[model samples]
Target: MQRTDVNTLGEFGLIDHLTENFVNKQQTTILGVGDDAAIIAGGDEQIVISTDMLVEGIHFDFTYTPLKHLGYKAVVVNLSDIAAMNARPEQITVSIALSNRFSVEALDELYAGIAAACKTYGVDLVGGDTTSSNKGLIISITAIGRAPAGRITRRSGAKVGDLICITGNLGAAYLGLQLLEREKAVFKDNPEMQPKMGEHAPYLLQRQLRPEARTDMVDTFAKEGIVPTSMIDISDGLASEIFHICKASGVGAIIEESGVPIHNDAQLQALEFNLDPITTALSGGEDYELLFTIDPKDTEKIRFLPDLYIAGEIVAKEDGVKLHTKGGNIHPIKAQGWNHFGE
Candidate 1:
C-alpha cells in the first residue's frame, strides 16, 4: 500500500479528495460541497444546513478562552455560514465531548452561552448529543436555516463586473487572538500575573472571544431589496473567501486596499504586534463578517448602507485575482487564510 500524508492535501483539498466519490442521490439534495452551506429542498422554501467543529487544542485554548465565549462562538460560526447563504438561522444542534477534567458546572457555563446565543440570534436549541473523550473538550454545532424562494445565495453565482462587498470590519479578531496568546505565555511563566484584557481593548477582545454572525446583514439585504450576485462569510480571511467566490463563479477580482475596512483599534494593535494591518485583514480568520458580490445595476441601493464597503469588482477569469494598494500598487491576491493542516 502507498502511504499518503494528509497534510500535503491541506484541509480543503482533503475534503475534496475524500468526498469526491460520494454521490448525492436524492432530489432533495440541492448541493453537496464547494459552498458555505448545503442546500436542501423544502416544501415552499430552501433549507440551509451547515456544521462546524471546534476541538479543544485545535480550534480553541481554554488557557486563554472562557467556556461561555467558546460555546457562543461555536454556534455563531455555523450561523455565519447560514448567513452566507442569505438565510435566517432557525435552530441548532450542539454536541459535546469532554474529558474528566471538566465539571458539571463547566458544562452549565457552556450551555449558558449557547442559550444566550440562541436568544440573541432568534433561534431555538432543538437537540444535540453528548459523549466522553479522553483528550479534551470538543464541540460540534450544526445550524439549520431557511431562505425565501429564489433568495438564497451561493459562491457560484457571482458574475463578471459584480461589485464585491463586505459588511462590518476585518482583522480585529485575529489581533485579539495574538494578544491572548502573548498574555497566556506571560501567565505560564508567572501564574501570579492574571490576564486582564477588558481594560485596554474591549472591542477587539470581544471580536475574538465572542463574535456575532452577520445575521443582521442578511436583514439589511432584505430591507434594501437587494440580492447579491454571490456570497460567502469571511471566516478564513478576505483573500481566501475571494478565491472561493472566484473559483466557484469562474471569475477573478481586484480589491482596493483602501476599500478594505479595518477598525482603528485593530490597526493600532497590529502595529503593536509588529504586523501590517492590511496583511492581517487579508489573512486573518474568524471575523465572521460577510463577503459578498452584488450586480453593478443594483449597486445604487446599497450605497447609503452603513459600514457596507464596496471593496472590489469581479472580473473575467483571464484578468486574474489582484489587489490594488493604497499607494497605487497592484499585486496578485494570495490565499493566506486559516489552514487546519499546519504548514
Candidate 2:
C-alpha cells in the first residue's frame, strides 16, 4: 500500500482527491466544485451555497477573541464566499460543538454576535445543530445566496487579457493575528501585563477579530453593470488565490508587487515584526477581500469603482504565473498562501 502524507497534498489537493469520485447527478446541481460556492439552478436566479468551519485552536483562539466576534466572523466568512460567487446572501445554518466548559451565558454571547451579523447583512438564521464535544469550540456555517442569470462568476471564466483585481487593503489581518499571538504569549508569561496594542493598529486588530464580507462590492458591481469574468474571495493569501484562478481558468497571470494593496498600518506593523509587507500581502490569509478578473474594456469603469485595485493581467497558461517586482525583476509566482493541512 502506498502511504501518502496529507501535507504533501495540501488543502486544495486533498479536496480534489476526495471529491474526485463523487459526481453531481442532479440537474439542479449547476456547479459542484472548483469554485468558491456550489451553484444550484433556481428558476430565475441561481442559488449559491458555501460552508466554512472554524476550529477553536486552529482557526481561532478564544482567550483574547470574544465569543460574539467569533460568531460574527463565522457568518461573515461564509457570506464572503457567497459574495465571491456574485450572489446576494439570503440565509444560513449554523452548527456548533462545545464541551461542558461553556455555559448558557456564553452561548448567548456567541449567538448575539451571530444575530448582529445577520441583522447587518439582512440574512435569516434558519436552522442549525448543537452537540457536545470533548475538544474546544467548533463552529460550522453554511450560507445560501442567489445570483441572477449571466451574472454568476466562477474561477474558471478568466481569459487572456482579463485584468486581475482585488478589493480593499491586505496584510492587516495577518499582522493582527501575529500581534494577538504575541500578546497571548506575553500574558502567559506575566498575568498582570495587558496586550500593548495601541490605536495605531486598531484596523489591523478589527480585521483579524471581526472581518466583514465584501457584499457592498457586489452591489457596486451590479450598479456598475460589471460582471467579473472570474472571481474568488481573498480568504487565502493573494498568491494562493491567483494560483487557484490560473489553474481553474487554464491561464497564467502577471501580478505586480507594486500593485498589491497594503494599508499604512500594515506596512508599519510588518516592519515592526521584521517581515516584508509584500510577503504578508501575498502569503497572509483571512483578509476576506474579493480577488477577481474583468475584461480589459471595463478598466475605465473599474477605476471609477471604490476600493478596487487592478493588480495584474491574465496571460496564456504556458507563459506561467509570474510576479513583476517593483525593482523590475520577474519571478515565478508560487502558491505560498495559507495551507490549511500543514506545512
Candidate 3:
C-alpha cells in the first residue's frame, strides 16, 4: 500500500480529488464545486452558499489579531465569496470550536464583533454549532446569499475581448500582515519594546484585520444594469485569481502592469521591506477584492465606478496568460500566490 501526501495535490487539487467521484443528483444543485460558492435553484432566485474555515496560527496569530476582528473577518471572508457570485448575502451560520483558554468575557467580545458585522452588513446570525476543542480556536462560517436567476454570475462565463476589472486597491493587507509579523518578531525579542507600526498602521492594519467584502459592488451592478461575464473574489492573489478565471472560462488574460491598482502606502511599505510593489499586488493574498470580467460594451458603465480599475482584458487561450510589464517586457504570469499546503 502507498501513502499519499496531501501537499502533493495542494488545497484545490485535494478537494477535486476527494470529491471527483461524487455526483450531484438533485435538480436544485446548480453548482457543487470548483467555484467561489455553490448555487442552488430557488424558483425565481438562486441561492448562493459559501463556507470558509479559519484556524488559529494557520490563518491568524493571536499576538496581533484581535478576537473581535477575527470574528468579523471570518464572516466577511465567506460573504465575499457570495458577492463574487453577484448575490446578496442575507444570512450566515457561524460554528466555532474553542479550548478552555477562552473566558466568557472573551467570548462576549468575539460575539460583539460578529454582531457588529451582522448589523453593518444587514445580515442575520441565524444558527450554528459551538463545541469544545483540544487545540486552538477554529471558526467556520457558511454564508447564504440570493440573486435573481439572470444576475447570478459564474467563473465559467468569461469570453475573449471581455474587460478585466478589479475593485479597491491590492497588496495593503499583505503588507499589513508583514508589518504585524515584524512587530511580533521584535516583541518576542524584547519583551519591553512596544510595537512600532508607524503612521500608516491604521489603514494597513484595518485592511488586514477587517477587510470588507465588495457586497456594495453587487448593488452597483444592479443600479448600473451591468452584469459581469465572470467574477471571483481575490482571496489568494490577483495572479492566482486571474489564473482561476482563465482556467474556468477557458480563456487567457493580458494584465497591464501599469493598470494594476496599488496603494501609495503599500508601495512605500513594499520599498521599505525591499519588495516589489507589483509583485506584492500580484502574489500577496488576503486582499478580498473582486476580480471580474465584463463585456466590452459595458466598459462605459464601469467608467465612473469608484475605486474600480480596468486592469486587463480576456484573450484567446492560445495567447496564454501573460503580463505586460511597465518596462516594455512581456512575461508569462505565474500563480506564485498563497499555497495552502506550503509551509
lDDT, candidates in the order shown: 0.84, 0.85, 0.85
Off by over 4 Å in 3: 1-43
Whole-structure CA lDDT of model 1: 0.84
Give the distance in Å from residue 178's predicted Cα in candidate 2 to where it truly belongs: 0.4
Clashing pairs in 2: none
Give per-residue lDDT, candidate 3, residue 116. 70
User: For residues 1-343, could you state the per-residue lDDT of candidate 1 as single tens digits?
Assistant: 3435434555556445433433444454566555665555575788888999998888899987888898788989999999999998876767777776766557666777887787788765554556668889989888888888688999999999899999999999999888888888889899999776653378888999999999998889999899898999999999999999999999999999999999999998888779989999899999999999999999789998998999999999999999999999999989779887653
Model 1 spans with C-alpha error above 4 angstroms: 1-43, 194-200
Please give the range of 10 consecutive residues that has the lowest summed lDDT in model 2.
17-26
Q: Per-residue CA lDDT of candidate 3, range 23-45, in tens?
A: 44444556655666555557678
Tell me how far the alpha carbon of residue 108 in candidate 1 is from the true structure, in angstroms, after superposition. Answer: 0.3
Model 2: per-residue Cα lDDT at residue 193: 98
Model with the higher TM-score, candidate 1 or 3: 3
lDDT of 2 by residue, 1-343 (tens): 3445444555556445433433444444566556655555566878888998889888988887999999999999999999999988877777788766766557667888887888888876655666678988999999988888789989999999999999999999999999898888999999999679866469999999999999998899998889999999998899999999999999999998888889999999999999999899989999999999999999998886778899999999999999999999999978988877753
